[model samples]
Target chain A: NAGVTQTPKFRILKIGQSMTLQCAQDMNHNYMYWYRQDPGMGLKLIYYSVGAGITDKGEVPNGYNVSRSTTEDFPLRLELAAPSQTSVYFCASSYSFAGQGSSYEQYFGPGTRLTVT
Target chain B: EDQVTQSPEALRLQEGESSSLNCSYTVSGLRGLFWYRQDPGKGPEFLFTLYSAGEEKEKERLKATLTKKESFLHITAPKPEDSATYLCAVLPYGGATNKLIFGTGTLLAVQP
Candidate 1:
């Protein structure tokens, strides 16, 4: 399995510009998440999906949107990007379900480094 | 508020030396605690997950032990390749949500 994969390892966007960070997983994970890592700030969840057509806001979801249309793909959209959005974004997936003991561990993609100027 | 904290922001150790990284947490209740190793410019790699207090798990050169208040990642015999930023996260016991709270991480550098 290729596990989780993300597109555009790096990108620089102008203020007010928009872009989509694509993420996919071959592990058939039912759960996927988007997180941003700022130096010394740890990982903050932006959004997550329990399954296709299901999504929820996380700790930090401002300026971001997400869609999970399939079990393998979860894309994050940044509308009107701001400098505050400059950070490394990670996409992760996990096979999880109630009563399943072996699905809590998450697998992560390499991540996308985004800088808004 | 639920939170995770890792100590010793950074450490330098000689190759073959042994050491431990600490992760202290404050949560209402914990479902599991996870340890991850992240190399510079790469994503985090999962190491171990402890489900309860008094639990211990080991890999080749790493052993993770968990207590009620904290978890420790003990490196038995460090190699240069073992150097990385180690992160800790906690999955709290609550609703169906599986969100995790993360720590800032402990950076380890093994010098030869």
Candidate 2:
């Protein structure tokens, strides 16, 4: 089903440059998220959306912005990139029904490797 | 604040050897604990989910057990194909979006 897909498998950027990492899911999930994994570090949450047109900040939201204009797309924007932004970025999605008592299992994309010099 | 920690940062085991990886967590109210397997240059693949103490789930050579403050992932008669970074994550009670807080992960290398 091509569960989840992310564009730009690898990228390199100069400091102060800007770009957007594209993510799309075909699972019809209501919840989508963006996370960054650094070497020897846990996956840190950056931003998430419960549904289209709804978004919120996560644990590590600084230097990143996100928008969910459609159910299938959630894009992460990096403005004025810095070295600290060099990391593997992952996009994940899940389906959750409120009050259903079911645990949500997140499905992740292959991830985008970004390097800022 | 919610936090998760995995032990033995890295482990190397010979073929057919057995071992366990540990995940310790601290949170106000625990909703669920999860296990995922990640290979090099790829995203994590979900393995198991434990809801409460005494809960256990098994898949092939891996079994996951949960407790009040920690979780254990046991690998039995492991093969080289089982080598990967094992990650644990927690979903706390009262979380609005149900986001998971993940650990640094345990990197396992099995030699054939």
Candidate 3:
């Protein structure tokens, strides 16, 4: 079902360059999230969306931007990529069934590894 | 502050050895605790969800038990493939967005 798919399995960018990491989910979920993982560090939320046209900042929202144009896609944009932005990025989604409960077992994507030089 | 901490940041065990991973959290009124498995170059795979103390869940060789302040992921006779980083997260009250506070994770290496 391609639960969550992220584009550019791996990419290297020169400092100051810009790029976007694409994430799409076919599960028709109402919640989508973007998180970045650094070596030996836990995944940090970058941005998230409750549904199309609604997005919010997460724990580490600096150095990144996100847009949710449709329910099926949530893409992350890195402007003027810096070395600090070099990390593996993951996209996740979950159902909003419980309203507030254990329904947050987020399904993650394969992740995109980006290295900025 | 809302936070999650995983003990024994790294662990090494022989195949078939039984052990457990711990995830301790401090939050204001915990809503839920989540466990996930992440393989190299892959995303974190969902594992178990514990809603409250005394709650337990199992799948394959892993069993997760929750207490008021912590959670344990028990591995029974684990295999080499069980080698991966196990992550725990906590959902605090305030919103229904499932905004999670995650731990650094426990990296498990199962040698055969």
User: lDDT: which candidate is best?
Assistant: 2
Candidate 3: segments with Cα more than 4 A from true spot: A97-102
Model 1: lDDT to the true structure: 0.95
User: How far off is residue A41 in model 2, in Å?
Assistant: 1.7
Residue by residue across A1-117, what tens digits does model 1's lDDT show?
888999999999999999999999999889999999999999999999999999999999999999988999999999999999999999999877877565487889999999999
Docking class of 2: high
TM-score for chain A in each prediction? 0.97, 0.97, 0.94
The best-first sequence of candidates by lDDT reads 2, 1, 3
Please report, as a residue range, the 10-residue window in candidate 3 chain B with the lowest summed lDDT: B93-102
lDDT of 2 by residue, B28-80 (tens): 99989999999999999999999999999999999999999999999999999
Which residue pairs in candidate 2 have backbone atoms (N, alpha carbon, C) closer than 3 angstroms, thus clashing? none
Worst 10 residues of 2 chain B by lDDT: B92-101
lDDT of 3 at A40: 74
Docking class of 3: high
Better of 1 and 2 by DockQ: 1
lDDT of 1 by residue, B26-45 (tens): 99999899999999999999
Cα miss at B73, model 2 (Å)? Answer: 0.4
Task: Give each prediction's DockQ, rounded to 2 decimals.
Answer: 0.89, 0.87, 0.89
Backbone clash numbers for all candidates listed: 0, 0, 0
